[model samples]
Target: MIPIKIPREEKLEIIANIQNHFYREMSDEIGDLAAENLLDFMLKELSPHIYNQAIKDARTTVEQKMMALEEDLYALEKPIR
Candidate 1:
């Protein structure tokens, strides 16, 4: 699998958020490098699962639409004598 490469701007934002969370929630300070490493770790470990779940969700939605379309087509049939 290809590595997730976040843009520098967005990565900086995420690192800031992580540092803030550590300070507020854990009352511990996290350095910029530590926060960035944590972010990279999460992306590597969690992104594949998240991406797979999203594909599953989209597939389910398409299946539902197909089923509804089939039913609608049946409704359009004329009654036979």
Candidate 2:
């Protein structure tokens, strides 16, 4: 076993730097994991629901527009087809 003689002030500074680096890395890792989980949940649960609602809304709007256009066309006098 090698005997280590670290001065108190130097030891404190080294410890502080090591702790800061550790916490920074940990925070980054946790943030990435959280973002990935959130994206996965949104894709799995929320995206499909939102996509379906948008489709339903689009269909309703298209049908209403078609109906209105048909009525307008009927009101116009048509030339010989």
Give one digit per residue, the lDDT tens place, for model 1 in 1-81. Answer: 788788999999999999999999999999999999999999999999998999999999999999999999999999999
- lDDT for each residue of candidate 2 in 21-73, tens digit (9 for 90 to 100): 65687753334445444445545676667777999999999999999999999
Each model's TM-score? 0.88, 0.53
Could you tell me how far off, in angstroms, the CA of residue 60 lies in candidate 1 after the best superposition? 1.0
Q: Which candidate is the best by TM-score?
A: 1
Q: In candidate 2, which residue pairs get closer than 3 Å at backbone N, Cα or C atoms, i.e. clash?
A: none
By summed lDDT, the worst window of 10 consecutive residues in model 1 runs over 1-10
Candidate 1: stretches off by over 4 Å? none
